[model samples]
Target: MATGLHAPILDWYAENARDLPWRRPDAGPWAILVSEIMLQQTPVVRVLPVWDEWMRRWPTPAALAAEPPGEAVRHWGRLGYPRRALNLHACARAITAEHGGRVPSSYESLRALPGVGDYTAAAVASFAFGGSHAVLDTNVRRVLARAVRGEEYPPKATTTAERKLAESLLPPLDAPRWAVAVMELGALVCTARAPRCADCPVAAACAWRLAGRPAYQGPERRGQTYAGTDRQCRGRLLAVLREAHGAVPKAALDVVWDDAVQRERALDGLVADGLAEALPDDAYRLPA
Candidate 1:
């Protein structure tokens, strides 16, 4: 049976959804796929302009596939996780070569594409094609945890129980909208911290709200810290490459971080990850 909270949340989403370009009626499956990939671990505010630029430059999988992989990384800019850029490039190539330039609609086909994981495949299928999939992102998980399970927060990772709950709560007729609506409810109303309970349409039915919103007692959830980490060093190195139109000298990358050993390790890791290439001239450049 559909959860009772489905109607209110779906209605709330219809009235309160963001005016994102990718959400427009005209957005193609490829566009939806691109948006999903860009949104992984990145916020919508940062992804907007990049997505717009990508749409303008490479509107189709064939167009993006024709370009060198390095160009994709170059255009990825400071959105972070340049590896995703490479994966998108690979996906485009696969789509163009194998799928005849169209974003494959089937969950199996989408998941087969490079960088497209189960969540992403499900998201694209649901959002772009109106498939009846249970989109279990972090926000949706939290919403379900609080509103249904009466938990303060979901576990660190998605569990089989959560997936089953999501499937059970999924509405049959309006599955796509329901999936997105649940995600929106989690993103806007049932946020991680300082949720706007009064504005939430399903607040009255929320298990956590009914339970007096007890503090989470299960485990400590630590926020990711970026400062002084190898990831920071990597971001610093990638920034230099992203800014350069061509291969940058070793000296250019050296200035971004004070620790030469960590910086070198980060750069080497990037090369290994296929985000950057080590040139014969001993300089670094984004992969081609």
Candidate 2:
């Protein structure tokens, strides 16, 4: 009688999982990994076309690793978080050099790679390697919090207790699909702002909904401000560099932002993060 939430969620997912490209039976592990990274904080609609282009250009980790990081940055058009592009490029290189161009199978080896954080590591391990680990992305956390723990929302970050609770609910057999099922539920049904509770598979057992589905009475989750922030300045600077095939003049970048202090700080941050390199003549370009 699958007392907790994982069983019914997995069953529901089998019947209702979205036909996402990355979830296809023949999709390679590298492709799945790329999808996971791109899907971070990015919408599915935006990711689909970019993902297709990315896979066509760089079919394998070795393919991406062999190319200059500049190409990756150029390909990451309008993704907002450009650093994720740099990290992903570095991750490909690490996979090529260390894992013989194959995405690693074990959680330890996958987690050891550059930019392969907890969520990514778990995702790859479960989806690619068929491990029974619970891949707790934001969506999975929210669904579990509401359906099982009776919380209106999950925490700001993944907690140890959350992982334990999720793992405890993971059926020992075919656990990878179970993880995907819960995540799919969150994505398609149990959405962030307005969950389709009427169609939720486990609504009959949902603790939060049974408790009258009270609105999130606590202080609302603060949205991150993007306009006029340093992140915007960084975006401006990167746009100039990405457009240039070779090193770009410092004066050319200076035109993008007016504030000398903020612009310089953003550039410095880019250089510090290894996404950009200061050339011999104070020009800047994506790292070779």
Best by lDDT: 1
lDDT value, residue 186 of candidate 2: 92
Worst 10 residues of 1 by lDDT: 1-10
What lDDT score is found at residue 237 in candidate 1?
A: 88
lDDT of 1 by residue, 119-184 (tens): 999999888988888888988899989988899899999999999999998776979888888888
* Stretches of model 2 off by over 4 angstroms after superposition: 1-4, 217-220
TM-score of each prediction: 0.97, 0.94
* lDDT for residue 33 in candidate 2, whole number 0-100: 88
Clashing residue pairs for model 2? none
Worst 10 residues of 2 by lDDT: 1-10
C-alpha RMSD of candidate 1: 1.1
| Error in Å for residue 196 of model 1 | 0.6
Q: In model 2, what is the error at residue 63, expressed in angstroms?
A: 1.0
Candidate 1 segments whose C-alpha is farther than 4 A from its true place? none
Write model 2 residue lDDT over 1-288, tens digit each, in one string: 335566677778878988999989889899988988888889899989888999999999999998988788889888768777877898899988888889889988888876678889989899988897878899989987888778889887778988888877778688888888888889999998889998887999998999988777655788889989999999999999888989999999999999999999999999998779999888999889
